[model samples]
Target chain A: MIATRPLYTPLDRIGWLNTTIRCVLALLGSYANAVLLGSVIAITLSMPAKDATMSAIMLGFVVQLLAVIWVFYARTLIGAFVGLALPATAAAVVLHLLGASL
Target chain B: MKFDKPRSLRKSMTWVHTWTGLPLGWLLFAIFVTGTLSFYRLEITQWMQPETQQASIYDQGQGLSTATKLLEQYASDAEFWSIGFPTARNPLYQLRWRAPEDKSGPENAKGKAKSNAKGNANGHAQGNGKDKPQRGSNNGHNATSADTAAKKTNAEQSQPAESHLAKGADGDKIKPQQGHRGMMQLSLDPATGQVITPRETAGGEFLYRFHFQLYGMHWSIGRTIVAIATFFMFTAIITGVIIHRNIFKDFFSFRPRKGQRSWLDAHAATSVIALPFHLILTFSGLLFLAGQLLPMVAGAAYNGDPRGFLRDYRGFGAEQAAPNPNAAKLVDISAIALDALKRSPAGIDSINIKRPGKADAEISVTTPEGSLFSGKQSLASLQYNGVTGDFIPATSKEHSAAETIWKFMLSAHMGLFTTPVIRALLFLSGVLGSVMIASGLVMWLVARQREREKLGYLPRGHRLVEQLNVAAIAGLLSALGAYFWFNRMLPADMVDRSHWEINGFFAVWGLCLLHAIVRPHLKAWREQLSLATALLITIPLLDPLTGGNFIWQNWLQGQFAIIGFDLTAFALGLGLLYATLQVKHKLAKAEVTKAVPPASR
Candidate 1:
């Protein structure tokens, strides 16, 4: 038996689409995380408002990088989507409850 | 590792990288190149304004006194005055005053009219000096010569009155003076109180603005586009790293002249070598524009009052205060400057006096931050009671931890406070990043061409990408050369000369694109690359002809910044010349091989 390469695999196209979704999710998920994290620190921390704001901004970059890396390392597309969406949603709810504007 | 899986994560990452990078590669190149040049922006501006002689050294107290005297003479009734003392980079005292409401119009017009008359008087004086030989000097003609000289002096003295009358007649036709606005900038000689009129040129400022705002677009739109491109760039760099399994190996491996393999190797090597710089520059670029792009966080926190957040983050309140109406005695500004220098030793960067000659006047002297990495937080400033010239300790506040970190990141991104060696390293990294993107674009075309070659036919899209690669990469260099050439060649007195220089830049770039489209890809590459080579090489040669200081003179004077620019241009020109020659040689060899077919063998 001889091994051969497929000329036009449908799975490759599906994978490309999954990667695109992952990228979009990573971006949105990280943005939401930055906002939620920033507000929580601002409201809960005993530090000055400016200090908390700076900390939140710094964490934003870190979370964004992690989220992007997670998108690639997750086992499946659905798994990655769920992994990102859950935290993003939890953070959003907390922020809303805290009366955060965005 | 082992044999490849059919649906691997690495493959997906590769797909993500390719798709994200290819679309914005050209823009990234432009941004990187211009941003790199901005590191030397001050030097470029210094070279452009060659007529302004560099102030060798000046007593700080003397310079401050000169500034104070000039302000007293020209703007005693003004509400606010700012004095920027001479520095190594800029050798003139930059003074600006905000006029009082009552003094802004009629007083300003009268002042301008008087200055115009004075200028005419000066011109007539020069004319009188030139006609001395024609007045005759023999003993018999002495009386006539004396009479002629007296007549000429009388004419010179009357010239100003005549010009003033003519100016008044045409005053209605003249448009309202823009100088009637609140603030007016006046450049003064540091040693003397006399004003110095420097010629106008955009110089390095255009390149600095071009990096972010681009040209011929609203700044907001341009910044948004740049932010978006920066986001994609950040993504692509991440994906690219994730996909590269042999990252360390790729850093050491480069094979030149192997066609597609060479392109791939060069791209990988350049990317890996400057990977850290790419990551930092992209992330920090996005952060620098975060106020515009990610305003929601600040908005949510402070009810859309971004300025409030910035004020707190910077640890300083606004520089201006409401003016006191009561008249007050003014203290010597030089005393305050000297006192501030005694406290900080680095000398003052600038001094701001609010409500000058008023009871509640405030003076602030700012010194450059000692640490190069503090960004906006590096302003070590002292506030003084304007009337007493006594330091006010309460005005200087310590920054919070958050503000310090934010300032550090911002300053790091701008490369402010960088030593020459660090600046050179950053510049080299930027160049490598540019080359990495250019080679990546070329590799895309090469890969497609190879695939098409297997099928014995090339696609139209592949040809288009090839042409675009040549036009964008090589054509941009040629356009930059044209921009520098135009800076030296444009008429100094032409209206809106700066805009014309920029227009010439775009026009030349547009012509290169047209040439790229019309000619074959190989021929276009060779021609544009050769043109860039010639233009870059001749820039230094034309410096002397264009009234700019020569490279050798700059070298002799220990002006490393100007010499660095000329040497960099000469080296880049040499590199392009080498590339052009290689391309020509390759083409000739290909033609010779074609002429002697394999059938002859």
Candidate 2:
């Protein structure tokens, strides 16, 4: 849904700048997303703090990996940014509501 | 920036794989190659200092007697004494000890160990309490080995090589050691328990340390760099799998002599074959640095003090030493070590004696490494009463599922807690991983061959890649070969001898980079590979001629580690030789094609 084919079919070229921006967005965005995701898991889990911290960290790795792929897999910049930002925003809000001090 | 149309996912992922894989691929290659070689870190170290070859498997009775006698003489007043038995990995029994803080000479700023005699000495072990995540798993995950392993890299980087101080020459003050917190290590012959001064060679410790934290930089910096690369590597692997499009087919498929396709085929085959290993190692590698990489997880969870998480996770609470004036004769530690070794399949890694001479003294004997599911470095250590020498069974703690999985990954990455066969397999898989990275790098250059040919010249960027590939791949091998050569060439009595060995390694690597920059790309590859091949093939020769036991002697003694080290060196040499010849053939073929018409038709 994020990728709409532009009407002009002849202008199909990938620019280095676009790719770089995409990379920066993906790495930083995915990282931000993963941290919040991990923090949430660490707080919400009903397990021991040590176990929760370790497990959340483990899931963080997977989340970051998937977020990176999603950024690249998306057809547009808006799509990539939104893909990471939406989840990250949700995670942050949930973290706040849970009364966990950041 | 010009906008590009939305591309297919496959195309997009290919770009991701290419960029992520290529830019940092050289660094990754170094990490992979060294990490692979580290599967036999102890064996290689054993081979490097042939003097340690006299050591054989631990004979609990006689070995312990000798070790006990040495400890009595050398470190009687030590706050801590650690004795590590000879396992299949490290055939030498290693001894380490720390002077009490109050006894630290010169405000502890100038801690130094000056051994009474000349021989190979191990210094700075990986401190289990710190630098856990930054350590290579193979650094003898046992307490003693960890300390031994940790201090080794410290010796490589900062301090001059240290030897155990002569009884009368003990310094008034000693500097704190790195890794295992500045513990001093001595190599003891398993048979006689006499100290064997191993040559100050680079040993396997240099490469093992280099693989994780690099050299010549603060460990945290080097570790962070490695961590970042590992993150990139994880990204590459996921993208690689996504972009593969035919993972199962790639597993079964291999194409040779097809240039770009051949390179791609090799990459795919190796990647698919060792897919599980790559995933585990990369992720576990990340987890090792997880405390730093995602401190927020610990910070948020443990109220901002990450140390709290570490302390709780490691189960290390302060143990106050009981000061009992009553003097009791300590029982036989050898028996305890042997008994514990039998019960714990990992074998005895280290025996730490705290307040060793007093009635309330304690002896904790740990197995080689932690269990697959336990968070602790040792699954359950066998403790003994210092004065009475009574056995103390460890209270087994229940492991949660999450902790179990987390610990399992960490233990698996350490590559301990396994039979020799499994270690060998891991080594082979590491070799495959190295190949996978190498081929991927070469394929990138090969994929651009057409553009170069059409332009009749190499672009600046392409030329840069060419030089890096040659230097990082064949050149690194050459440097490694030189390190072994230097180990043999350097005199044993040279001060800071192992440091000299490490210096030779960097020196040769720098020379290789220079050579790569100057020589023609193909010739450079051929030359470096030839040198590596020559060095590797003849490494086994140094074993006997350079004071190490012969392969046959090692075999008769059941020291397969030495034999394995020799044969592996020879095999790697032969592999490099094959690669060299291939490059030579390509060089010759290109010459012919250039001489002939551009197109015969």
Candidate 3:
């Protein structure tokens, strides 16, 4: 989405230009991605297993770590899509395989 | 610095408030309106469920007695037996049994597994006497007491705290139990333990579902949406305050006259005056649920130690457990658990026994009472040897002061540990907040119309804004009204009643949008809002027609839940009617003034 009449002002644009905004956004992105991914994993794992407590806790930790990394490095929209999609796809496949084998 | 405000300061504040409010105004408006309606979710549910109308208010004493009997009937050593006392809107006692177990299953799953699967069909207190100890099911010890079980009564004059417990087995010590669970409310006849009113049938449940689509998708996704919406809402409220400079002057400036100016003033007045409340509610809502939404930040920031993180934010500790799968049978639940909980660090109002009939199982009792905003304070779990009947600690360390602070903040924000009177106040305030948002949206539409007339052909910017206004305000109102209709109209015996109810909510909302887009903007707003007004007004009327009455026949019998619904519906109906009249007057005046040319005078 291109800027529709520049929501940011000159001062506001400068504020975004400041290094701190980038860092904050990056951190927030990483955090958000990790939470989103982990939550997805937690929920998906919770589906089949009669006991989801342990899985929810463990998957929550691992996914969060991965999400943080994805947020920091993945800059473009395409990158973000891949960053979110890849882990989710991988997790689903693995979980399905685990369910089948069990 | 002199505190006196200059014109520049006034102008700057106005700019600040406007910018702050504009971006997130739409989302906040949705939140406020939905949330306010959510306050009477139970009442709405009662109005919807006609079958539950007669048996709405369960006898408290009878309910408690039945729950106790059910506890004994299910498992003598059930780790916890929690009961939700009946409220004005939902007069049903909810009872749940928790049993201690090992990581695998209940302690005696192999041999002593009593087939509760059979007793499941013995629903709604059929008086089959099947629970009266059959020849095969009965052990040697039969302490089944049935005296005065049906005649449990409550003195209306007693204190709220005193009312929760029956005269103890000894008629001395008061037993603490779980209070109401708002969103997940299910009405059951305290007399029969049969599902008198399923939560799926309740109106509040739809709001709960809408808030978090507990459907095909995962909870995390819903939580994230709710969180992001809350974040945007906070930002908008803050910006709104900054953008409106002359906020105080417009506090009482509501002109119930016909014009866009009048609309703008009303909207500005409500939002500005209650700005502080709106901000507090949104920020606090996010804060209350931060752990669920922002867990990564919590985990990473606290360095993978869930305990540390909880300690810092929620005053809760990870309950550690040492599994003893081969323990003895559980002790008397009502007596043993309460005794142990009293000994524990935090006070206990609720207890959960996982893996009943197990050797190594946990008995987790929590006292969430008075622990709001403290994150996870008032949680103390005791893992006991189910076989040996020994108490085991869930965690070693207690919550720190900082964690407690976080818990308190959370509790206060959501009014978690508050009394009924305070909760009612909060609920009222929530309604006001919703009205404030609705009025604001209307004001924007009114202002744009004036601008449109001046510019001719309605500027693209104005048209887009106006369309969005119709879609959000009118569309949302119609959807909400439809939810009530669905509740009353849907087949009571429909399979998957809960799922269908939620589907109905979204379906109606979708239809509203479709209708709005096709219809003229002005007509859609008036018709839908007027329909909403009628539906709200008719809700109370439906009660008596559908078996619920506000008269002595119901109220004298302690059927407060149904009566409360009728009164609340009537109140909301009046509010909607007032708003509709205001809008109609404005439209009338605008048209009349336009028709009469100034030169004729």
Candidate 4:
């Protein structure tokens, strides 16, 4: 008997839905991570007072790092979400402690 | 359009990729490596020059005062005394003075028209008797001679010796003086006018030169090459992005198994992960030479004034006019400027005196310590009148928003302003960048190994590539390690000591390549790598032996450049050792698996 198989099996309906939910979660996580990291950087750089431009740069760097993490683990959507979000949340909390208004 | 066969298109595209990348792959690899290292060239200099280690912590007040006094005394008649403040990488305060009439003697001269005939057969070798009679006939010449004789006889006059004009090969009167370039550090005693620091040649400047100007080429040629390279690099990055459709997927997909597959995976991963860095670096490197490449545009748009373009990009006023020649006069209160600088809230780093003591002379103050790249392009400056000590009405845009952004970008690129943590991060990224290249090179070899075996002759093409791989990947590192060894081992009193060190570096590198060509290929790789690893690890040990501080002390004292060099060398050594181990493991496994028949193996 001859056997034929694919390396990756096609996703069932439930599997497809699960993957979609995970991917959406991952995207949200990445966004959150970026905001949080940006906030931390903004707070650290905000000498004397908080400013808009420095905040923007911080946001950009955070976004870049988040994108890097997300892209690498995107196939494992949930893993990507967790990997990105943790850094973001941690940064946000740290910034809050450091007296960032936002 | 009709639908095309996807398979044929893919094959053709693959071929295009291979052909495009293969030719410049090694050159590109070297550029990336050296460029990364060059980011911290100043720090590297500090690490290598142990003499600088004794310099104390930066004291702005003392440094400024010292500079003020020094400049007032020595550069009082200078066109400009551009003082460079001490930093983490360079502890010594450096100053440049462009004075009138070539201040130093002929000993510092670069080239000389050899005195072909020591004595003239007719005692007219230097000048004929007729010319001497003409000189005697002139009363003005007699008066000048009498004044010079009186000055020589004076007990108090500590002025430099009078220079006698020499006849050149063409019989043109030549005023032979030191032809050496850059600033000379004057002696401690203000009146002496002697050299104290033995005059350091600009080695770091050469690295800067190499970035734009390659060796064995004129400045124009080098600049054109650099400009073109910069332009193509920018285009390459964009094309690379277009080509890497699955960049994300390849980021973490490193597989160091057998030959071709491993190299491909390594290349993909390195090329993908560092995309942002590569893009920024290539663009910025080009941007540095923008004026050279776009001279026409700059000239047309900015009224043919290069300063106008600089002002637009950097957001600053034109620097104060350079002082006119022969209008210099030493001012009183030399300490005043230094005091004012020290009192500034942000703190002062260096004080540059342009055309010292002249009416048009300007004193420029700056932030002293910064990243190598950032320092080359100053962050902030305030200019003042040299004679009056009045604040010159120059723009302080260096303190402005746009200028600050430029400084930050420069700092980020150089891995300086962000703290030690960022430098370490960048260093790791650089290592990954190197690995990516190494694996790619190896992959090419593996891919063709089978073809060579089938052809009965190990093809010359693959062999050449392999030889280059060994030479570049292992050879460069070994050569650099040897440079340090030579620096320590060569007798301290050796003449032209630094040049010897540089020569030693190239010599070792040349020998490594020679060995690669002569020896059987695998042994060359193993031996060179193993030896390089040993030498690298041994450098830190030699530092302590040479009476330099121990690694622990350097680290604890926050001597980052010093400690960093040792740690970097140690890490590289370990890396090479690891690679050697991998090679051994693979060879052993291949032997065990009997992939080749007993007769062929």
How does each model score on lDDT?
0.62, 0.70, 0.47, 0.50
lDDT of 2 by residue, B1-601 (tens): 2336646877877887888899889999999989888777767777776766665565644566766766665556666667776766776666666655533332222111000101111122212212222222323322222113223332223322223322111132122223234455666666655556555455676787688778888666787788889999998988888888788887888888988888999999999998898999888888877765777776568776565566567543334344675666666787777677677776766677766676767777766566667644453367777777778777767888987877777666667566788887888889999999999998888898777777776678988898999999998899888888887888765656667777788898899999999888888888999999999899778778877777888889887888988898899999998998998898889777773223210
TM-score of 4: 0.64
The better candidate by TM-score, 2 or 3, is 2
Q: For candidate 2, give the docking quality class from DockQ.
A: medium
Q: For this target, which candidate reaches the highest TM-score against the unseen true structure?
A: 2
Off by over 4 Å in 2: A1-14, A98-102, B1-3, B56-61, B102-180, B317-329, B338-347, B368-370, B375-378, B595-601
Model 2 chain B poorest ten-residue lDDT run: B111-120
Chain B vs. true chain B: TM-score per candidate: 0.79, 0.85, 0.70, 0.72
TM-score of each: 0.79, 0.86, 0.63, 0.64
**Predicted structure with the largest lDDT when compared to the true one:** 2
Rank ordering of all candidates by DockQ, starting from the highest = 2, 1, 3, 4
Error of 1 at B404 (Å): 3.2
Relative to the true structure, candidate 3 has a C-alpha RMSD (angstroms) of 13.9
- iRMSD of all candidate structures: 4.6, 2.8, 14.9, 15.7
Extract clashing residue pairs from model 4.
Answer: B79-B355, B80-B355, B349-B368
lDDT of 3 by residue, A38-93 (tens): 44443454332211222343344435434433332333333434566666566556
lDDT of 4 by residue, B271-366 (tens): 677766665665555445544554322322233343344433322332533336556554443453555456565545455555566555556565
What value does the lDDT take at residue B159 in candidate 2? 27
Docking class for candidate 4: incorrect
TM-score of candidate 4 chain A against the true chain A: 0.57
Error of 3 at B339 (Å): 7.6
What is the descending lDDT order? 2, 1, 4, 3
Question: How well is each residue in B1-601 modelled by candidate 1, as lDDT tens digits?
Answer: 1112245768767766776688878787888888888777766665665544433324343456656765765567777677777665555666765556533233222111100111121111111111111111010110111111111111123323223222211231111111212334555556554444433456676776677757777656787788778877887898888778798888788888888889989988988998888888887787666655565555445654544455444333335344567888888877787688899886666777777888988776666544544553345357788898878884444666766756666666667566678878998898898888888887887666546646555567766777777778888899888888887787654566656667788898889889888887677888999999999988778777886768887766555666777888888899899989987886677577753222111
